[model samples]
Target: MTTKLPTLPSLQIPFNQPFATGKEFDYIRQAISNGHLSGNGAFTKKCQAWLEAEIGCHKALITHSCTAALEMAALLADIQPGDEIIMPSYTFVSTANAFVLRGGIPVFVDIRPDTFNLDESQIEAAITPKTKAIVPVHYAGVGCEMERIMEIAENYNLFVIEDAAQGVMSTYNSRPLGSIGHLGAVSFHETKNVISGEGGALLINQPDLMERAEIIWEKGTNRSQFFRGQIDKYTWVDVGSSYLPSEINAAFLWAQLEAAETITRKRLALWKQYHQGLIELEKQGKIRCPIIPQHCHHNAHMYYIILPDLESRTTLIKKLKTNNINSVFHYVPLHSSPAGQKYGRVSGNLTVTDDLSSRLLRLPMYPSLMSEQIELIMNTISQFLSSQ
Candidate 1:
């Protein structure tokens, strides 16, 4: 008898779901018909105002991408050649890339095993005479130890740049992630909770820094004032780049912001479901779910499972693929990556990062993911673990 194996299922579960189209089109069209399709138009202003009011940001500048927003942060902070920035190794390449682009040394530090964020305890030890800023990335939408990090930054007179790209609406001690530092950056890439296709925002927390923030957002020009009629004409005041995103993208994001509470409730429910459902597997020493701290509320951005080792994690991913599930690993420690080697310094061992990256696998988690899909994914994992 000939037996046939089933084909691997297309992730039908994409890494992210872009915005809902109908409302988005209406909003975008409203911006266009209102006679402005350029940057900082009506839609852009609405988005910015909402972010400032709701997200606890003093002001927000919608940009082309989070990467651009981060780069602007580096520039505004005056990150110069030979300056060092402290950040966790278990982060998106952009976190380090932004600083490095401004000729800043990326001082890599290990992450907490549980939170997968920068180990605040290790940050002070990594600081040097030239250390300029400390960038704390709130990994997986869980807030980092901001209090301790801020204390350290204050003591050393180092600037704090919160990479709150995933921490939108997620808070630390009741204060929003982006609003906690001197400056912060948020992402609206298709992969993030919010959507503008390819967009982001820079959040200025320091009241004194808002003017410079706006100037840099307008490509180092005083155009923001000109647009406000505060000036008759605008010209380059200092070095800057084109960071503002078009009104269309900002309109799309406005829809998401309006539905933020709804979307967050659903995602948080799904996150709890995953936790409760996977707890059995965790107890069996098969997988580990996220460790949510008492003081924090997470945004359900990423749901990861840490297998016992590299081999088990790889095997699980392969098994999930065969069963029509798409699971992926993240961030091989940057220090070991080719680019990290070229520009950064790895002070101590990244044993935790090395271990976790190999062992961690992110599952299908989104508002659209069905209950049936969840059960099927878990059943497949159970079957695979039983076999092992």
Candidate 2:
């Protein structure tokens, strides 16, 4: 008798898929009819105004990308050569690169083992005279301990720039994630919950910084004030860049922004299902699910699990692939990367960051993901763990 192997299922699940709100085309057509495809046009103002009102920021400037927003932040914070910025090593390179562009030093800190956020406790010890800012990345749309971070910033007179790239529609202590810090940056990449293909926004919380932020968005010119009749003519009064996004991108973003609530609600529902389905595995020590603190109301931007070790994580990922599930891992620790080693210095041990980087695996997460797909993913994971 010949031994037989069970055929794998044909279902294919990708790591991420961009969600459409059904009005992107309509808005884009409207923008085209308006005859202003340039940056900071009518559609741009509409998006900016919506963000300012919704997030309660003093001013909001839409940018071409999150990287642009962070770079603008570095300029607004007046980051100079040799200045130091403290942030977790577990974040995307942009978190450090923005400040590095200004000749600033990145002081890499460890992350919290549970939330995978910058360790708030270690931030104070990392602070030095050269420390100019603290860039706390709100990983997976889960807010960091902003109150403590804010208190530390107040004590040291350091600027706090919330890297809220994944924190849109998420809140901390009843306040929006981006609005709590001195400045905040949000992403609209295709992978994010709300997307504009490649878009971002700079949220200026401090009233003093709003004027300059606008100037910086307009490429170092006071063109905004000139348009508002606040100046005789816009001129090169300060250093700035063309950080604004095209009206087309803003128009597409408007549709997503308007439907943000409904999309978030549906994603949250899927997140809950995954949590419920995997609770047994988490309890049995097979995997560890994401943790949300009592004060946090995450936007369900991602759903990830931490395996027991790197080898186990790799094995599980392979198993899922064999079953046609496209699971993926996240960032390598910045402190351990080549550029990070060259441009940044580690303040303390990054044990958690390194460990989590190897162990964490993000599952399929998107608003458009079907309920049947969610069930298939959960069942496949459960079966794999059970066999282990």
Candidate 3:
């Protein structure tokens, strides 16, 4: 007699589902009717103005992606070859790749185990004469200790370029995450809270950089000034690239931006459900939940948990796969990657980054993620941990 093997469940929950606000299609139609589908059109200007007002930044320029914004920041910062930029290792490749493209060296630091942000305490020790800037990544939409980070930058005469890719609606001490730094980059990737399929913005807090930033966003030309009647014609004034997103993307993003608060609330509610449901597992020492400090007003960009070890995380992922629930692990610490070895150097031991990268797992999170889905995910995780 042959015993039948258990069949895997059909995929029921995906890792993320891009949300659509009601006005997106309407805005796109309007943009098309206006006959300007190129970058820096009416919709793009509206999006830029909205971001500047919302974030209270000196200026905001829409970019093709968060990577483009970071690259623009690198150019605006005037990073030179051999110049060092301090940042945590437990961040996306774009965080390092931007500066690396400018021939700047990335000095990696360890992260805080609680917040998974750059450890503010370790920044000073990494500074040297060649240090040009400090890029603090706000992991999981939780703000970094910007107050301390900014203070350090001031004393060292270093620029603060905030990698606020995951922190669109997040805040630190009531100040917007991207608005505090000299330059901040926000993402509108499909997975982000306010998405336009693939878009980003550069929040320029320093008034001095505003004009140059616009030039850089327009591919090294002073066309923005020319359009504003500040110049008769535009010409390449400095090094830059085609960082701007087209009007279609801007129109879609405008819809999301208009309903930002509602989307954030829905995501937060789902995050809370996951948090409350898994509290017992956290209490039982089976897993660890995300920690948001009192000062941070997070945007609920993601909800993640820390398993006991890599083996445990792997097992849980397998279990979730069998149950048709999609969960995922985050970045491989940039400091440990091949490019990092060639373009960057670790200033201190990335103990927390190394450990967390192996143990952490992100659950499905998006504005469209239903409460029932979250409950199912939590229940599946609880069962897996209980069996372990």
Give one digit per residue, the lDDT tens place, for model 3 in 1-388. Answer: 1111222245678888778877898999999999999998999989989998889999999999999999999999999999999999999999999999989999999999999999999999999999999999999999999999999999989999999999988899999889999999999998899999999999999999998898888888999899899999889998888998989999999988998988899889999989999999999999999999999999999999999999999999989988888899999999889999999999979988999999999999876667888888888998888888
lDDT of 2 by residue, 275-370 (tens): 998899999999999999999999999999998899988988899888788899999888889999999999979888888899999999987677
For each candidate, how many residue pairs have backbone atoms clashing (under 3 Å)? 0, 0, 0
Q: TM-score, each model? A: 0.96, 0.96, 0.97
Which consecutive 10 residues in model 3 have the weakest lDDT in total?
Answer: 1-10
Error of 1 at 223 (Å): 0.8
Worst 10 residues of 2 by lDDT: 1-10
Kindly report which residue stretches of model 3 are placed more than 4 angstroms away from their true locations once superposed: 1-10
Q: In candidate 1, what are the lDDT values of residues 6-89, reduced to their tens digit?
A: 322465544444435357878888888888777988888888998899878888999999999999999989999999999988
Return the candidate ranking by TM-score, descending. 3, 2, 1
lDDT of 2 at 71: 98
Full-model lDDT for every candidate: 0.86, 0.92, 0.91
Clashing pairs in 1: none
Kindly indicate the candidate among 1 and 2 with the higher TM-score.
2
